[model samples]
Target: MSVDIHFNASALGSIQEVSLVLFKSWSEKKTLPMKLTKQGWKVSLSLPAGEYKYAFIVNGGIRLNDPEANAYAPDDDEKIWSVLLINAKGQRLHSNQSYRVHLHDYSLATRFDGPGLPGVHKQINLAIDESIVSRFEFTQVEGLHTVTLAWYTPDARLLQWSDHYLVENETSAPIELMFRCQPKTLMQSPLLGIWSLKMFIDGAFVLEDDFKVVDEEVYSRRDFLGCGAD
Candidate 1:
């Protein structure tokens, strides 16, 4: 069987150190093929049909959650990572197929291709349950930028509502709405903010926007309550 693992560091310029452990029964042992790269890491291993446990060691200890891992083991302290066991016929041999859960029907909306500047604008419309839930005014800079929108549930857990925006060329370029994330609870009051903006064009850094996040009180008192609440 072939196994692949991938992951990325949480912060820019941070080096990710990693290790892989393979276990079969309590005694069976083998070596596996592994490789690491700038984007993440990958490993390929061949094994007999059976159950096994693998661990990823990173930063001097075991790591959790391969961002690119498609399998997971439920652990309270860590997000699960994906794993797969395949048969000689190239079919996945790990069963319990009836209980598998899948996520669908999630979406994000934003615009690309805007004038490149600090206040260049675009709008984002979000709808849920057939109702218009929220709208966003995205301001673009000359390079890469991140916007963080967050809210709190009635239960008081802070939830993130966010996306990334990239401006590829200095002139008129095709921009992307790129990534969008939706929090699981609608009961949470939605809060939004532009967390950071780092811009680069023609392979050189041009500008950076790392503003002090406005105090939570400002968002709490505002008339807009995020994407889901009136």
Candidate 2:
């Protein structure tokens, strides 16, 4: 029996075109196109258990591998290909089940198109139960830029704290690292409300953004923050 696989190429966001290629088993060697969905660019395939080499063709020319690839190997032409190991006994949805399946465990990668400058933006986590996401996307000059985040409850209690580092080469346009403050995990329940967020860049306070969580799609906020968040 073969296993159904779902590959996500949403890291590049919505661009010109995103395609997939399979290698290793000569019979399954082919290129497949991905569709842009609400969650992101996704494509499903059926295959038996085996270690296959694959790569993504972006815009019909660029041969890019998955950003979240587990391993990578060089092809005969020295071109690199991402590796994926499929387990025959892996967990899967029922044949009649109408649900989504992630490549591995549920990856928490969110798609954020940073067409604008450096700042935090609000997004919804469609992969989950449509939760809240405070996505932070930005670009900067050389040197190690450390992003420190702290989430506080409405009562001013510390909810979550996280930090990430990014080192860029000496260039004008560098890849901007994407980070987010979800305030909770898929396993744990979320506390819906406007949560305060304090961000620090390289040890200094940079900015403060709030995440207004709700169960609906409409965007809104109160005129005044009842808590003293200064």
Q: Which is the leading candidate under lDDT?
A: 2
lDDT of each: 0.36, 0.52
**Candidate 2 ranges beyond 4 A from true positions:** 1-132, 135-140, 183-189, 216-230
Whose TM-score is greatest here? 2
Q: Estimate the lDDT of model 2.
A: 0.52
| Residue range 9-87, candidate 1, lDDT tens digits | 4332333455665655436533343467656666766556655545554444323333333233432433232344556
Clashing pairs in 1: 70-82, 71-81, 71-82, 71-83, 72-81, 150-191, 153-188
Q: What TM-score do all the candidates reach, one by one? A: 0.32, 0.36
Runs of candidate 1 with Cα error greater than 4 angstroms are 29-34, 74-82, 88-230
RMSD of 1: 15.4
Clash counts per candidate, in order, are 7, 0
Clashes of 1: 7
